[model samples]
Target: GQQVMQIPQYQHVQEGEDFTTYCNSSTTLSNIQWYKQRPGGHPVFLIQLVKSGEVKKQKRLTFQFGEAKKNSSLHITATQTTDVGTYFCAGPPDSGYSTLTFGKGTMLLVSP
Candidate 1:
């Protein structure tokens, strides 16, 4: 079965630092999507990469698609207390939606 895996399920950072997370899939994916969920909030779309070896950035955050489209990563230049939340990497489902199957996610905790 095709499934995505993420490491360092949890992370803690101080204000004004930096953090990065990685994602991997057992099988190749057609596309991948990254989402963020703030505390007490629903998942929000951040960005999506379709082409192989694609990379995109939003402010201090950077997203990348692996050359094989089977892995992805998110990097935050600098951390902030408001950066506290869970970051998820979702890939196309093996069966339907072709949309994405979200990994458990990497939770970020920022301290003031």
Candidate 2:
């Protein structure tokens, strides 16, 4: 069985501040995905990484995958009220199945 864990279950920041979250897997992953869920909304896929040491960015958000493919990170720059939400990292284990295991998620709160 594979397990994904995220740190700092919650984060609070004032407008214009930055935030970051980390994820670790119990087993190596073939690929990893990131998602965001706004208040009362379903999770929305943000990005996916398949290669080792991959990095991607969307506007003020940045994502990174470890070279070992067992860890990941997400960073947001200049937080805004609109950015409040929960971020989740998921991935499939070395197993051959397509099912993915998701981390607990990091909840972000932004204040003006």
**Best candidate (score: TM-score):** 2
Residue 4 in candidate 2 has what lDDT?
Answer: 95
Write candidate 2's Cα lDDT for 6-28 as tens digits.
99899999999999999999999
* Tens-digit per-residue lDDT, 27-56, candidate 1: 888888999999999999999888889999
Clashes of 2: 0
Model 1, position 62, has a per-residue lDDT of 92
Question: What are the runs in model 1 whose C-alpha is more than 4 Å off?
Answer: 93-99
Highest lDDT: which candidate?
2
- Show model 2 residue runs off by greater than 4 Å: none
What's the distance in Å from true for residue 67, model 2? 0.6
Q: lDDT for every model? A: 0.89, 0.95
